[model samples]
Target chain A: MLVIEGLTKRYATGDLALDDVSLTVPKGQVMALIGPSGAGKSTLIRCVNRLVEPTAGTIRLGETVLTALGDRALRRARRRMGMIFQEYALVERLSVMENVLSGRLGYVGFWRSWFRRFPLADIEEAFRLLARVGLDHMVDKRADALSGGQRQRVGIVRALMQDPELLLVDEPTASLDPKTSRQIMRLIIELAKERGLAAIINIHDVALAQQFAERIVGLHAGRIVFDGPASDLTPEVLTTIYGEEDWSATIRKAEDDDEDEPPAVEAARIAAAD
Target chain B: MDAAAAARAWRPPPLIEAAWLRWAVYGGALLYAVLALGTLEVNWTRAAEGLERGGRFLGAFFPPDFVTHWLEIEEGLLESLTMTVTSTVFGVILSVPVALGASRNLAPMPIYLFCRGLIAVSRTFQEIIIAILFVAMFGFGPLAGMLTLAFSTIGFMGKLLAEDIEDIEKSQAEAVRATGASWFQLLAWGIQPQVLPRFIGLSAYRFDINFRESAVLGLVGAGGIGDTLNSSLDRYEFGTSAAILLIIIAIVMVCEYTSGFIRRAVQ
Candidate 1:
């Protein structure tokens, strides 16, 4: 379980990105953090991993108190949390396999990582992850050579290679098309379920968040405004989170999607088609 | 009609807001140029006589005698080539750490300031001046020339490499760090690949520059092809001097072409 008590992140420029945000995510729970731009959703997730150091708060990932750890201990703690980024932040010049193997960097020595001499089991696991993502053939290709969806797949595989207990997915589908976004979201949800990993996915698309995540946390102006089941995200709640807008269309669209075939089956069918 | 007139009436804003100030600046520059020209005090008669003598000097250089001074020419050329290669290799090796330290994003404030200071010191003196000092200290040999070139190369390569490091895609490095990679691992996987192409191109360009500078280093008694050219000129051996000059030009051209090819290949 991940417990955050009074997590606050005030940047050096004096912007309070996260303000006294406290929440707990049970093991195997996938929570979607929905917020408007500058609403501190990214900061909240980054604080859990200590990527953005919390100004005044306690972040406890299971038994380990993340905020109190020294440099070496912090690195060891970070290995348990895999982070997926927006725009698929893969090293553009590195091969897909190298990018995937980089997730095991904490486990291996510097010389091993430098010479690309990863352990046998780690290499096998990387191959399996790539194959599972259907990117086994493109392993030799540079990260820059892949398409948007393909790069995101590589990013997902890289995150998974860490064998993390929690996945910190930040705007994973922001740059993707609507269909690809849904597919990636479904893939993340499925993977989280398969591994029993807790996840905090920061998303902009409310409807997608509703479809994939069981729980939703709404942040606004560095404060948590709403935290409830995905079904509880009504027009009023969205208005509270993202300010007054025509949310009827958004709410209606989410309802319309829910009435269709079960998301898992739909995702499987799409995967097969692909 | 009003819209059409408005569309046709656009003009860029004046750079200098005051028209009088702009005209005054222009007038001042023109006045300074005229005054500077007047200060030169041209001697037409002396210039004409010198031109005639220059024609004779040029005539003496033709049918260049390469056979007479081939041994010294060969030795000087060999020394210059060795200095260029060894100095370039040593300089590039030393530059890597300095470049890393100089990069603001990579190093702490004290290290960054120190590395930047080192680059500033190296860049303060021209190659010839450094060569003169090195020769004075090291007693007029290729050792001085090599040291001079290597010292200058650190500044040239380090500054550009640091700038390249600073401009690398931060998101890529951030992702690597998020993986819990150690600092060294982060550099290897994250930073190195992004800047490798630019680094290769710079090194090749620097090698070309060092080769050219090596010839000039010999003028200050730091051994190179310049030594042969200087001695030939001092002895009034115009033919031998012309031969050496031609050889230098050919070598420079070859270096330029090879470096260009290497850069293009890497990119």
Candidate 2:
């Protein structure tokens, strides 16, 4: 489980990006953090990894207190958590195998890692992960040579290679088409379930969040407005969470409102749209 | 009435203001114009008067006196060429470490500051000034010229190499760091790859500059064909001076072509 208490982040310019915010997730749970722009979603996710260090906070990862740790200790703690970025921040010049093998760098000896002398076991694991992601044949290809979807798949494989205790995905499906988004979401949810890791995702698509996560936490202006089962997320609740009065008008603008269609059918309709 | 009030509230004071700037530019220009008119007029008149005398002197230069000193000139030019080549190699070798140390990406704060300060001190003087200083220490030889070129290259390449370091992608560095790489490891893997091509290009350009500079370093008794050129000038052998100038120009052109070819081949 992860515990955050009284988290506050005041940047150098004295802007309070996150003010007294706190949230928690139990082990093996899929929790979606939903918010519009400027809701501090990305800031909150970065704060979890101390990328955006909080001015004041108490963060507990299981029994380890991460917020009070120094740089070295924080780095050690960060190894237990895998962070997947929206842009899939893999080194473009490096091959897929090298990028995945880099996931084990924290565990590898400093000398071995520096020389890229990855252990045979680690190399085998990297190849296995690549195979799992349907990129076994592309192991030697540089990251820049891959398509966007292939790169994201590689990104996920790299994250999985870390064998992390906690999985943090920031807008994983934001850049993908609706069908691809569903596939990515399914992979994330299924992988988290299989690994029994804590997965906290920041999602832009409401429907994807509702379908993929058992627990949905709605964020509005750095505060959680709704925290409950996905079934409890009604149009009225969405309106409250989004801070909009005529929320139905937004959903009504969708050309297809066929309730009987499968999720894939809805994905098809969205794919055909602008 | 309400609409008028809203319009009045919306108006800003001003977007562009240049009153003080205009006055400052005008005042500086006026001061420079007065100083130029006072200081340069006499010099210009003297230079104009000397032009006729220089033309008469140049008229005698066509029939060069290469007969008496052609062998000596060739020997000295060969020495200069050797000095130029030697200095370029040493200068590039010396600059690599200094450039890496001064680069903020590759070095820690203490090392970066120390190397940057050293480069600043080295670059403060012209190469001739440095050669003069070295000539006093080493007693009038090619060694002095080599030392000057090496120091100057360190200064020039160090500053440019640091800037190239600053321009690399932060994400690549962060990704390397996220792997929990040590400072040295991150620099080797992350910074080196990003800056290597540019660093090589800058060093090649510096070699070209040092080649040209080496040809003239002997004017300060640092040992090159410039010593011959100066001697020729003193003996009123303008034709020999012209030949030395032509040789220096030809050497520079060859060096330029060589560095360009090597750069393209490597990069």
Q: What's the i-RMS of each model?
A: 0.6, 2.2
Model 1's DockQ score? 0.84
Query: Relative to the unseen true structure, what is the C-alpha lDDT of residue B48 in candidate 2, on a scale of 0 to 100?
Result: 88
Task: Give the alpha carbon lDDT tens digit for every residue of B1-267 in model 2.
Answer: 599899978855444357677777889899999988887645778898899999988786776566678897887788777776777677777777787788776689999999999899888999999999999999987889888888888788878887888788876766656555556666766677677777777777777888788778879988878888888888888888877777788888987898898778656
The residue-by-residue lDDT of candidate 1 on B3-112, one tens digit each, is 88988997787888799999999999999999999899789999999999999999999978898999999999999999999999999999999999999999999999
How well is each residue in A99-182 modelled by candidate 2, as lDDT tens digits? 787677667776887688988988998887777667788999988899777777777877777788888788988888766676
Assess candidate 2 and give its lDDT.
0.78
Model 1, span A1-274: residue lDDT tens: 9999998899999998988989999999999999999999888888877777889989899999999999899999989999999989999999999999999998899998999999999989998888777788898999999999889989998999989999999999999987778778878888889999999999999999988899999999999999999999999999999999999889778767757658786767466324
TM-score of 2: 0.79
Residue pairs in steric clash, candidate 2?
Answer: none
RMSD to native for every prediction?
2.3, 5.5
Worst 10 residues of 2 chain B by lDDT: B11-20
